[model samples]
Target: MTNKKDENKLIAERRSKLDLMREGGNAYPNDFRRDSLSGQLHQTFDAYKDETLREEHIRVAVSGRMMVKRLMGKASFIKLQDQSGQIQVRVERDSLPEGIYQRFKKWDVGDIVAAQGELFRTQTGELTILADEIRLLTKSLRPLPEKWHGLSDQEMRYRQRYVDLIINESSRNVFQKRSQIVTYMRSFLEAADFLEVETPMLQTTPGGANARPFKSHHNALDMELYLRIAPELNLKRLIVGGFDRVYEINRNFRNEGVSTQHNPEFTMMEAYRTYAEYTDWMDMTETMLHGMVDALNGSTLVSYQGEEFDFGKKFMRMTVEEAIEAYNPEFDMARIRDREYLADYCVKIGVNVQDNYGAGKLQIEIFDATGEAELREPTFITQYPTEVSPLSRKNDDDPFTADRFEFFVAGREIANGFSELNDPEDQASRFRAQVENAKAGDDEAMSYDHDYIRALEYGMPPTAGIGIGIDRLVMLLTNSASIRDVLLFPHMRPESFD
Candidate 1:
């Protein structure tokens, strides 16, 4: 580890060079244009022989941060890193304009530089750029963290993400893959005729999910507002207004605890299709996921956290009760639907029992505690309790449960979908029940949005909606263990410089 004194000394030395550059009148220059990426150069030239490259005399301009610098008397080697990747640049004293080589020798490893050179192959068979011109673009004030040990401190990595991304290729790749994942999802949905729409991030009343919202006061209007926890309600309103198929990919905020799996602010893709049932959404989800896996990874199998999941196979599906029974064999299946039995079971399993809790809620609690984690494969746990799913339609044969399914992989919830509850009366009653729960001290309960109820009165067609957690999905696809790894700038505690 570099001690505070050593780090400060390095910084002072770099600052001295910056002071000299400032005296010369151009400490920062912005007019350098690059004609090639490091990766693209390697791709185009790696296959050719040294004689072929000399004959072709391919000239290109490249700019990136100097990652590696080997000062070897007359000739030196420095690797420049761009967005694509890094390429080796060979700088010779004889090849550069009179005093520039001296200045390049003083340049730090983290300095951004632009170089124009001819492509050539080194004696060792590696592609190289023999530069005739090199210009310092940006003077990096503080030296980057040691490249060998790299950025290993998790807190510091999240706090100083810019440094982390520069030093860690895996971190950069994860975010790149995250972008590709979102792009793939958007393209897939667009191909299916889903219209992308934006909804307000600030809401008058937060609904659509049972999560506490981050509150904000509108000073001009003298009214309270909230950062939306989910866009489910507004997206549904669009459905009622005649947009049969709608989707939104945006940020949602919640006043919640952070965990390996949870973030207070996160991204989600919520899509709704009118005249579609939960089952239809489930099938669409399967097709999309299967195709996504095949497209991104070139295979239907994914290895995550040492476990292999086969998207090639149909995702396992079972009712929530069945999942509970499958994971907890000792539970009496005959009394699974009994209210008193479920309450007792919940208490036996150390679940916090509430006065407003019903048999359906108890079953959900038990399942969450015992069954959720055991679902290591891609599985859809369906038939959620109506007590917990206020917006979902009640099952035709069983009014106690809703037509909902939560998709899980590696035991973490990834997506949730349900048949919409279009009946205004039923939805209103459920909203009242939620309000009562809030009054009874459930801070995560939903507030009744009367406007949504009014929208339902206008008669929305049978619709199905789903919200896919983009961060978690990225984690799964990119093999990132923490949600922080997938987020470029996840929320962190303020650092005390003192």
Candidate 2:
């Protein structure tokens, strides 16, 4: 909590400063305009130092927050940083009016200012601007973080992202890359004839993905609503409505634990295309990911957490059974129906297998615990057990497995796609099973949605759909290790209760 006295004291000081500025006839003038950016000026005139001509003089107006200041008796050197880049500003007492130099000396580092200056090269061969006049646009009351040390604390960086962006150059770059990656992804889908669509984020029944929902009350209707866990059900409805190719890049909310890989609210790009299956989605995933890597990294190869991963190379494809065999050769696949044997194996491997877990669920838990992290490169783990993949189409050869695949990179699941289950009866059965599981123990279970089943009954096309974790992809492209690094303002526990 803020102390009232301290708050009042700060407010009084700011008011006094404003009063003095207003009396000087330039409190908050809005007449200044910037003709060129700091970076554009540097790029255009950086090479004109040696062959100086009278006609080569360039006058540019630039505005930015002062980042650094070096003061001398009569002349001073400061660095002005705009959104494009930074340029050195050389201010001299002789250049400005008598009292203007003294006023400029009182300006702090974070104050926003506009300067009309001539471009030149400094003694150190650096591009600079020699300012003839400087106007203070806005004064920053709070002090910025130290220039050399930076905001090293993770919690503070996430909570106070503005400060983080100022002190940490890498943080700004990560967000820049994130924006570029999303823009490129949108272009890729649009070029492929996929129509971008919007879906409801709040639904009465949170269906589509197996996850716990954050619930809220609708005061007018006196009813309950859920923040959507996934936009799968509604997006598929578009398929039934004859929009064959559609995609949505949006946020999904889940009431879940937070980890380096997970956030309560995260972005996902979900798309559906008619007449395609999981195999078609696999090819699309590889091509799009390779393109993104090329755009950001200039190569398909990227390094993450000490491992070099190649996105361009053919991703390794394997079934769940194949992964199981490779990891545990001694496990008897024929005897997988034997619950006791599976339970014992789970205990040995330190998997949290509940007593209610059947053969398929236990296998998923074991695989996630042991095999997931071992997949360091891009690989598609396909043919997931049907019990855990309720909304996916069952394989023709084996009813126990689904025609699904999850793309893994850097030991993390980045994308999930499958041949969607379009059969209304089958989907209803699966939803029943998921509801039973939710009642029994699992909180992250799909809810029974009758409307979604009705939509399925109207005949959805045989479609292939995918949901790619956008934040995680941004992290990979930006070489960011934590979820917080890419997110500008990730959620955090309140530091003080008011």
Candidate 3:
């Protein structure tokens, strides 16, 4: 979009400014230090009256980039912004050394500067810094975007995040809140005696989740590897190794299409606990979420994008069949269990269900088509079909369903967890089924990992594991509309300079 000619013209103008800056000793000086932030000044002095501030003579040294500037015949006003916030700076010909004010007049908006001044309120009641001395710390070569509507292009915003952070306070706040969310999650889990651990991102086999993997080759070893789609297997291996409880917050890679809810690479926090069941995990998850909401907002109720989600109340729990019945009473629960009936309904709803899919898998497709979008609040869809939940424990009373639960908020899955399938023989059988699924062109089906079966043979206790999409959680908590909005550098198609 930016043509070569216009780009060159701006470059030349900035270069001319750089020449003038070189005349000043050490144009990009780093030795300048600040005693306080702009936010600190406002916090400590915003309540003081103009006469009170002048009487107190609160001299403070601060440094930031020039965000706003208005020069008069002999005096000037500029807004200086730093990490914390922004404060106004007043400059007069008599305020600093005679030549310094003249030199400051030539400086541009994006230039970083250090100022030493006394705090006082302007006639309009703004907290201001009347500078006694000012110096440019770093000279910005390119001018900032236009004065008012700064960096509004969504694509440009993600591509150049530094500029986005500079112009948009809300954008910076989203990432800040994301950090808080992660911290709260980690702290809460640790408080409950869960150990945080690390797992390999690159693996010999992607056996954890049913997602397409990005494959790579290890040149040194002459072997193939995969960017792990999930850390489920490795984390469970830790469980077999005698660690009672563990959790990992890390990056996962999946060879998947880009969408509002998905990205190729994303963050997730997977946790496992020995001697725990799906019910135990569901309770812990709800308590942790409520604690997190309370910590961030002083309440457990959140308003996300105009929809009110009550995190304070207990979350709903229902079986997939129950949910389907609740959402669509017209569908016969008895007929839904029949393979042909479910398959026909799937086709009618435009959901592709292969013949390779068992009645359980077909039932899940029917549930997907009928019940998913009906969920508006926090709800746990439990009793997932065994065919689709390969690593989940099967119900003793009904082997057709696994003791699994997928947490949904605002109609999309945010977490998947279950009582882990620790029986070595059962796990092996499930892996073999997945292998057949893979052979049948289900690319997302997991590969067989004999090593995991061997680990299970050594005896893994009754363990529960859960994987929460950190990006999606951040999206919900921060009220971000898309996965891309939560992701600082979401993937995009290649761009051409021409």
Model 2 bad stretches (over 4 Å) = 1-19, 337-340
Candidate 2 TM-score, true structure as reference: 0.95
Residue pairs whose backbone atoms clash in candidate 1: none
RMSD of each: 1.6, 2.2, 1.5
Predicted structure 3, TM vs. truth: 0.97
Question: Is 1 or 2 the stronger prediction by TM-score?
Answer: 1
Worst 10 residues of 2 by lDDT: 1-10
Candidate 2 residue-wise lDDT at 172: 84
Candidate 1 vs 3: which has more lDDT: 1
Error of 3 at 299 (Å): 2.9
Model 1 Cα lDDT, one tens digit per residue, 384-434: 999899999999999889999999999999999999999999999999999
**lDDT (Cα) of model 2:** 0.86
Q: Top model by lDDT, which number? A: 1
Give the winner by TM-score: 2 or 3.
3
> Tens digit of lDDT per residue, candidate 3, span 1-498?
555644776667777888877885667788888999988888888899999999999898999989999999799999999989999999988988878888888888998988998998888999999999998888787778887988889998888788888888888989999999999999988998889999998898886888988999999999999998889999999999989999999999989889999999999999999988999989999999998998998888888889999999999999988987897766778886788887777787799988699889988887887788788899999999999999999998999999999999988899999999999999999989998998999988888899999999999999999999999999999899989888889898876777
Clashes of 3: 0
Predicted candidate 2 versus true structure: per-residue lDDT over 1-498, tens digit per residue: 344533565556655766788888877788888898888877787778723712577778889989999999999988888877888888998988778888898887887888887777777887777889988998766667788888898877898799888878888888888899899999999999999999999899887788889999999999999999999999999999999999999999999999887899999999999999999999999999889888878988888777788888999998877777677878888866567887889998888777678888887877887788887778999999998898899999998899999998888899999999999999999999988988889888888889889989999989999999999988877778889888888878876633
Ranking by lDDT: 1, 3, 2
lDDT of 3: 0.89
